[model samples]
Target: MSATREDVGGTPLPPGWAQPAHQPDAFEISTTTFEQRATETMARPFARRAIANATDHAAALTTARFVGIDHDALRDKARQIRAHAIANLPDYLDQWIDAAEAHGTIVHYAADESEARRIVAQICRDEAVTRVVKSKSMASEEVSLNSALEAIGIDIYETDLGEFVVQAMGDRPGHVIAPILHRTKDEVHALFSTMAGRELPNEAEALTAFARDRLRHAFLTADAGISGGNFLIAETGEVLLVTNEGNGRLTTALPKIHIALVGIEKIVPRRRDLAVLLPLLTGHGTGQQITTYVTMVAGPRREQEPDGPERMHVVLLDAGRSALLGGEFEEALHCIRCGACQNVCPVYRQVGGHAYGWVYGGPIGAVLTPLFRGQVEGGELAHATTLCGACDDVCPVKIPLHDLLLGLRRRRDEEGCVPRSEQLAFALWGQVWSRPLLYRASTAVARGSLRVIARDGVLSAKAPLLRRWTAGRDLVVGRRRS
Candidate 1:
């Protein structure tokens, strides 16, 4: 029931594949703080190893891809383009809407998550759609669109190979581009074999071929398609999408009705901007010179066109994005979703995306989670980083991730989202450190106590009052023994 991605860009699944999944969403936000969840992830040696290996390899490739190119200048231009777009988001959005409507595409506005969900569900209901096929769309995940459609009795299939695996297994994406970064090929083999009711080959290509077989059927039968926009060109009224696997093209083209849920921040004033942004997006995201399939949809197909959707819909979701327009965190809007920052981030490398407990993870996730979801649900994530500037250096758009993370932390502390104990401890710290005698005396006492508790100058995991920090790290104080 799916498109022919198997022959195109993917080596690509069945009813048994659609069976209920037992695992929670891999991307679902955890109720626990970063410390609690990170500890659990750290305990999973296999998952940690997989995550570290994938990120390091991707990070290295990204570095290699930019070797001969003027990577710095490209990144600077991209940053400028993104910054300018966010600055004039309103003007560009209005222009885009006018242009899109003139080109016969329908546009809908969503003030928040509830409205976006309602709009899409209503469209499916109005169109009498019962089955839907979807491409990988982070924006859809941001609004939890799949569950919403399923709740209304519409059968939804995630058509991209990784997303299809995620859907069948009921897991969320672990990394932005590589969704199953924390999973092993063996895990995929087991799942596919269980679905097939026979032993499948224990290989990547074989596994992909099986999935593609199942999904190709879904592509032809689905009544509608749902996708996310990587960038919206205001001048041409086209939603631009870039993908390595060809599913994005089929998902939007083969279906009679297509819906794109795009964050307002994804808009740009001109199509030419892609000339600068697309390379950085692909290079930083997967270390490719460019994505294999780049699709631009302006509206529905006309009589002359061989194949395309009969109707097109674009949902512009605000959902707290506009509030940051003129704020300190506005620069966070400049992100191109390259996932480069996540690849180089020490925190994300160790814990993966799930520990951030939101749709996104890593340094950008830490900033966006609190800004988009607010402090109550995501404030603690700001501390999930080491304030390391690795993400800042890697970001294709040049977003100041380190500063934005610090800003989120400051906002959390200012809003009393921080625990009372933490607040009190900081207050006491300020009091002690602000005085010369108190600071000297306190440091001396603390050093002596730590020296007594340490073994060979490395503090034990059971170190009093510092257990949390020491438990996951070795605090090497000095070479001298107590």
Candidate 2:
């Protein structure tokens, strides 16, 4: 997992990229198949309806928000900016490192997940940090940073309304933007009630106040704050964090020490690039013109400053990202973590994020899971989609999701990761299809067999060969009586 240092990362702070951080057993890989997981989620009608309604509404808002503008032109410009930043990533990182260090930010580099965990944990220990307040950070989830901090006997509180619920329930995030998209308000009410010892009101506003009251103590007493960066400005050496909640600002400003675990691919060449990138990010992610709180920090609190953390550290994490650079899959690096593709993906809407069995999900997840995790563990995810181009259409950075997914499928085959049974079936189909006579004969025989099995123009019962395929879908043979 050693990264190519020349291009992939910055210099380390200390105890350089070598400590073995604890890895959770079967961290993101599901114990069951995608079908099994999807079935389980589907069985929960509340969760299914919650996810569907939320996504459809978000997709609608996204369409409506961009109605008066040249949305395609904005997406194209954003794509170009992201493409340029990624293409010249190393140079931008070098400039950022120099500028950040000058601004009094201590920058650390982690080549992979284990190192990322080790780096942040070591920082906490070194600072003698006891309690920590945190904002939403997908990178932290990717490396399982909270688990690492807990292992060292530090108390960590998730301040974001949704993420706090996820942490309290010991559940993985269900969506990239809305971590609790699959959870209903009733479910949250129940959990909060149990926590309160007295039944709390089932209203959203009351529940929010309860969470705020509890988290305020954490903010005041915490020694450290941790967050993920939305964008890294290379020219000014600033970490840009956008959120609808004030937690991001509070998390960074209130704590004595602040640490940010940001992916290296998140870097942009200049602060001006945000003019092109931020609107697309906000519009596509939440369908808002802009996030409520936009915090940009170039360094820790200065001597003259009245607020902010005393010391700031930025951990530039590679974690399997640099491997994709200069390769066929590099375009994936251009993603802004908007989760727009997820909102429009039919498969994601059906099963939600958990079924993908990873930190990320939806069309981007299908491509990234196989690439970040190995094909042996995540290859099946590539086949989880219907090859629909809806994700491509909705992507803010214009990631060719369909092509990336297809590439993974092709790679899986080339690497012999696919099951032998499927290989044989496809091989047999290819052989027969190559011969026109055999193809015609096979189709005729299949049609004749189906007609016999058909009852009232439908194959109503599960048959031996097609049982799995027909379980949720109906196979209609002749014209309907109606």
TM-score of 1: 0.91
**Maximum-lDDT candidate:** 2
- TM, every model: 0.91, 0.91
How does each model score on lDDT?
A: 0.86, 0.87
Residue 49 C-alpha lDDT in model 2: 90
List, residue by residue over 1-482, the lDDT tens digit for candidate 1: 33232322222334434545654443345567787778877878898999999999999999999998899999999999999999999999999999999989999999998799999999999988888889988888888888888788787878889988888787778888888988889999999887666899999999999878776777887889999999999998899888888988998889899999999999998988999999899999999999999999998888899999899999999998999998899999998898999999988999988888778989989999888887898998888889879999999999999999888888888897877898899899999999999999998888888888888878978777788778767787764346
Worst 10-residue stretch by lDDT in candidate 2? 1-10
Residue 107, model 1: lDDT of 99
lDDT of 2 by residue, 247-358 (tens): 9999899989999999999999988889989999999999999999998999999988899998999999998999999999999999999899999999999899988888
Model 2 residue 287 CA deviation (Å) reads 0.4
Query: Candidate 2: deviation at residue 264, Å?
Result: 0.2
